[model samples]
Target: MTRPTRVDDLPIRDELRGQHAYGAPQLDVPVRLNTNENPHPLPEALVARIAERVTEAARGLNRYPDRDAVELRTRLAEYLSRGGVPIAPAQVWAANGSNEVIQQLLQAFGGPGRLALGFDPSYSMHALISRGTGTAWLSGPRRADFTVDVEAARAALAEHRPHVVFLCSPNNPTGTAIEPETVLAVYEAAQAARPSLVVVDEAYVEFSHGRSLLELLDGRPNLVITRTMSKAFGAAGLRLGYLAADPAVVEALLLVRLPYHLSSVTQATALAALEHTDTLLGYVEQLKAERDRVAAALAALGLEVVPSDANFIQFGRFADADAAWRTLLDQGVLVRDNGLPGWLRVSIGTEAENDAFLAAVKSVDVVTKKEQQ
Candidate 1:
């Protein structure tokens, strides 16, 4: 038999040689709260509307999708403006997902020899995408509580003077939202170092306890806010993400965007989702309530829980997080072990699903106590 070739057998980018793709475990379980996805299914009305729009788009399949995605951009702008920021279409850009949007930003602003910096334990993709784009990555500092150490961040900016900076509001895994003052301070510090592009990953902003940072875009040409339909819209499968930024930034991104990158079907589906925004947001309210309920339940279990502004909660001070995760899995519940040492994360599922997860946690506690005895 011929020997099987391994991935390392062929020459590949040295940076990607040993890298693992970013993902949570996708397992078949009764209560799966691993991925921070909106637990609610889209309403029937929205589904019907998506069908209608997609059907219309099918008629134009022979032709290319609007290369600039003008209509979709306009609708996205309108949706964002509802937050009172008055965003214009020219200042918005959409891509397959926030990942693609992040890649485009890196392609335009970060490349070989340039550095991109993000506080530790942020959206990992910031560093991953930087490496993918041939950009150097720098890890900045965060407080022990998972909040950005603003002064330390300023100092990092001064020292490295990276070309790009990434800030994640309502940061993942930890579920901590950055304060507006921190953002402003970082932006100022980044600019002081050089005219750096400061990108804010606001993918969870819709679920945040605080307001969206869109309003801060005024006169800040280097500032960009990236958002996604995957979370609040209950449309993770939609794969639509957009960014609000200065017009010039949008133009720069155009320089690197592939022609007609977004397919017609995606634009139509996203358009339909926008039409039913109110109904979808109603589900967001439900998730927010459920999130709070689950957080309280977890804290009541005597576990350490990080105050979250996203749909997921980060809880634990487990001596062995991996063991705790496996125990939950054994109990037919799945959650994320984000490699945060003593912590594990769980997305807020439906009321019943959350109840099951609580029960599983209680069981784990019982087992641990018995083993000690």
Candidate 2:
């Protein structure tokens, strides 16, 4: 007997390169609400600043960017301070994106027989990344409303004794945050039973009425908050995201990361992004206003709209959400279909775009998709 050749001879992990990681599509779509990206464009002034800085770095491309982006770290620490979660530059570390940042956290703390844990219907990336690290991932069951069950979470913690726990506030897909007390309880349970790192992925926090657990981090050394410029800041294309944790923990991450993990051009762009925090935050306010409007409209139309604290709304009562997802795409108003088979997730775009999506929904007899299917 002999092993198969070529593709068949490759490692299973290598074979997974072209496969879906978190069910996100890479195709170009007119309305891309499916990816939870901010619809706002980068401000002109900020663009100019980024251009100036990137041009300055053109001559330095022959050499690597600072293995540690010290200037960017200072800006990020100041940014976090303004948001009420005070931090220092020494406490922050970043990678290409929050996706990779989380991967670093996993590599430092999880893999093999070790376990990674999270709550159900939360960020799918948590489970995807955990498996990519060769770690066993477990989750507590979700409630009827799709939030995690606190008691179930405590039990899961006791059982899995996970090395890392990903807690996504204003959790993806469902669009509701885990309550503060709920998060606190989980932290206490984990600390009592085992040493675990609890990471709060606050990637969408700016759009969520400014509520964050970063304030709870001082005494909770085991907890960390990860942020991304991809959401409300409209920097997804640049792929910049960071982690804020104790210096000791940050040192652990720094030990394993590659030199020049973020390019000089990328660093220049992020530095410019920090300068426009106020302008970008104004956009977040606009999105929150739109989020409320969309939720109310969906409720009026007899859909069960989840009370969302994030920039998107999740509605129940679809006859077939998958078909509706395709219909929305055909109409150039793409949104995610989640929360079981008969629910949909719609991102809050600019008013004009939101109007177009709402009108498209009203025009369609959604049941038609089911009939055709």
Candidate 3:
């Protein structure tokens, strides 16, 4: 039998014909911060408990894992409730990652004839997943500073009346968050046009200065809030993402999710992490301070830094962002050139790692690159 030599040799979906996969380039650099990951590792106590829990779960490998993920969802609800919004496990849903959670949402609420919309320069996955699920995507506008303009957003929602609307707080690449009023404005406009689902992607909310929007979920049945353990929980490898919404929304997702989609080992590992939530959260507080310090230092370097609410800062006005990005990579430092002209983003890392990144940038002649070009 002969193996296919190229992707074109096989029968692939028309939409996926020439599309590139979504991801930052994972390069081996001394200071890697391209992806917005928690730079800390799980504490030893948590690691040990994970081993113990997985051992217990291994005994049940013969049977299927819990299809509903009741315990995990219950714990997630409790975590969100600590922000002052009481939630029941029935109001929650879980998946492999927040990306999968978003995909499942598009599958359930968006389709071939449906439409989905998101503010531009936000999460790219919102559009990619919509296309994959056969939902038409609409790009909304944001201000030059990267904040969503209230009137502009309302107009877009009223005009499109998309089946699903995505709002990312502490939005990716820009690191700017949305105000509660903006959410309300968009939600009201969407309802005015048509009864639609408003999805607030709060994957980075755990690191923000203010409270979680979970409180808003109380009266807004059309709203959904998605969270993940990947960033603040420092469990990117664990791949556990969950959502809080009305019980009916949770029930709706069940129809679209694959049977036993989550593995027993993932459940065991995430449960162990939850047991150490306090210890893990301490690390988040420290990172928040570091993030602020990084922002100040970047400003001191004469770079324009966007005010960040997440564990990353977006800073640049470079003449050639791609050239500057290559310069950083040459210094054994890695940052993201998110293709937003003249801009780049750097994830907050450990103190030493951050120092190295700062030093690398200092060594590069920021003005010289533009002059050279």
- Residue-pair clashes per candidate: 0, 0, 1
Q: Residue 192 deviation, candidate 2, in Å? A: 1.7
Query: What is the per-residue lDDT of model 1 for residues 216-254, given as tens digits with 9 covering 90 to 100?
Result: 899899999999999999999999999999999999999
Which one wins by lDDT: 1 or 2? 1
Judged by TM-score relative to the true structure, which candidate is superior, 1 or 3? 1
TM-score-better candidate, 2 vs 3: 3
Native-vs-model 3 lDDT?
A: 0.90
Winner on lDDT between 2 and 3 is: 3
Ranking by lDDT: 1, 3, 2
Clashes of 3: 1
Off by more than 4 A, model 2: 1-9, 13-19, 26-30, 364-373
> Least accurate stretch of 10 residues (summed lDDT) in model 1?
364-373
Per-candidate TM vs. native?
Answer: 0.98, 0.92, 0.97
Candidate 2 lDDT over 1-373, as tens digits, reads 8855754346776424454646755556666676777889998999999999899988799999988999999999998898667898988988888999999898888878788888777788888888888877887677888877888888888877888888888888778877789889888888877989999999888877547777888888788889999997889899999988888888998776877788999998899889999999899888899889988887776568888878788875667677777777788877786546778888888898888878777644456444646
Cα lDDT listed for each candidate: 0.92, 0.82, 0.90
